[model samples]
Target: MNWPVFFTRLGSAIVFAIIMMFGLLYSHPMAIIGLALLIQFLCIREFMALVAKIFPEAYFPSWLTMLTQVAGVVVLLSVPLLAIIPGFFVVSFILPVLILLVTILQKKTALTAGFTALAALLYISIPMACLITLRGGAGSFHFAIPLALILMIWMNDTMAYIVGSFIGRTPFSPISPKKTWEGTAGGALLTIAGAAVWGYFSPLQQYHMSDWMVLAFCAAVAGTAGDLLESKLKRMAGIKDSGNIMPGHGGALDRFDSLLVTLPFAFCYAAFFMVHT
Candidate 1:
C-alpha cells in the first residue's frame, strides 16, 4: 500500500462524499441530473478516445463526438416533456441514425460507427436515464438508496484493493492482473457488513431488512461485474486506464463503473419491492 496512492484515493473519496452529501441534502433533482450528465459526457469522451485509437481511419473528431453525445443527453433529459408529446421514439431513433450517418459520411468503418453510437447510448444515456428517473421518484427512500448504492460501491472497491494487496494469491482475470479471488471475497463481505450496518443505523432503517439485504447483494454482484466488464473493455481496447482525468484514479468510468451497473438494479428493486410495498 503506497501511502501516496492511499492518501490520493482518500482525499478523492472525501471530496466525493462531500459533494454527494450536498446534492442529496439539497434534494435537487436537476443538480443530480447535471452531475450525472457531466460523468456521462466524460465517459463518452473516454469511450470515443478508445474507439478512435482502435480505428484511427474513422476520422471521428472528439469535438463532434462530444457534441453528438451531449445532444443525446439533452434528448434523454427532455424525455418527460417529450413524453407528453408524440414522436418521441422518432427523435430517439433519429439521433442514433444521424450519428451513424455522420460517421459513415466520414468514411469510417461500419463497425466503428455502429459501436461508437451504441457505446454512447448504452454507456451514457441509459445509466444517466436510470439515475434521473430514480431521482424523480423523490420518495424518502430516493436519497438514501442512491447514497447507499454509492457507499456500497466504494466499500467494495476499497476492501478489494486492501485485501488483495495483502492476501491476493490468485488472479480473478488476466485483464485486470491486480484483482484476486481473496480480494473479491473480502470486498463482498465488507460490502454486506457495511450495508447491514447502514441498514440498522442509517435512515435506510426505514426499509425492511430483507429488502435492504437484497439491495446490498445486488449492488455487490453488479458492482463487481461492472468493474470486470470495464476491465475487459479496456483490455480489448489495449488501454491501461479509461482516461487520465482523475489523478490517482483512472477516469470517471473507473470511478463510477460499479454505480453504472448497480444503479439500474437498485432502481428496479426499489420500484418492484419498496415502491410497490
Candidate 2:
C-alpha cells in the first residue's frame, strides 16, 4: 500500500463527497437537475471519446457527437422540461430521429457509426433521467431513496477496492484484471449488510428494510457490472483511466458508472413495486 498515494486519493474523495452532497442535496430541484445535466455532459463526452478511440474505422464525425450530446441532455431533462418549456418533449422525441438522419446521410457505414452515438446517448441519459425523476412525482419520488442509492454505490465501490486489495485471489474478469471474486463478494456482503442496517433505522418512511436491501443488492451486483462495462470500454480503447477530471477518480464516467446501471434497476423497483410514502 502506497501511503502517499492513498492519502492523495482519500483527500480527493473527501472533496468530491462534499461537492456531490451540495449538488444532489441542494434545496431546489432545478439545482440538482442542473448538476446532473452537467454530469451527463461530461460523461457522454468521455463515452464518445472512448468510442471514437475504440472504433477508429467507424467513421464517427464530430457533428454527430455534438448532436447526440444535445439529444441526450434534451431527452434526460424532457420530463422536467415538459412542465417548463412544453416544447422540450417534442424536441427530445425528435432529436434521435434527426441524429439518425444525419448519420445516414454520411452514406458509408453510417448506420454503424450512428449506433455508437445512439448507444452513448441512451446509456448515459436514461439513468440520469431516472435519478432526477426519483426526486419527483406527487410523493412518489423519495429524497432518501436517491441518497441511499448514492451512498450504497459509494460504499460498495470503496469496500470492493479494500476487500479486493487485501484478500482478492480469484480474478473476477479479464477486462478488469485487478478485480477479484473474493473482493466482489466481500464488497457486496458489506454493502448489503450496511444497507439493511440503514434501512432499519432510516428516518425516511417511504422505503422499508426490504427496499433498502434490494437497492443495496442493485448497487453491489449491478454496480460491479457497470464498472466492468467501463473497464471493457477502456480496454478496447487501450487506455488507463477514462479522463482526468478528478484528482483521484478517473472521470465522471468512472465515478458514476455504477450509478448508471443501478439507476434503471432502482427506478424500476421504485416505480413499480415500492409503496410510495
Each model's C-alpha lDDT?
Answer: 0.73, 0.84
Cα lDDT tens digits, model 2, 179-273, are 89998999999999999898899887766888899999999988999989998999999998889888766888898888898998998888886
The clash count of every prediction, one per candidate, is 0, 0
Q: Model 1, residue 64: what's the lDDT?
A: 61
Per-candidate TM-scores read 0.83, 0.91
Cα deviation of 217, candidate 1, in Å: 1.8
Off by over 4 Å in 2: 1-11, 83-90, 137-139, 275-277
**Which 10-residue span in candidate 2 carries the lowest summed lDDT?**
135-144
Whole-model lDDT, model 2: 0.84
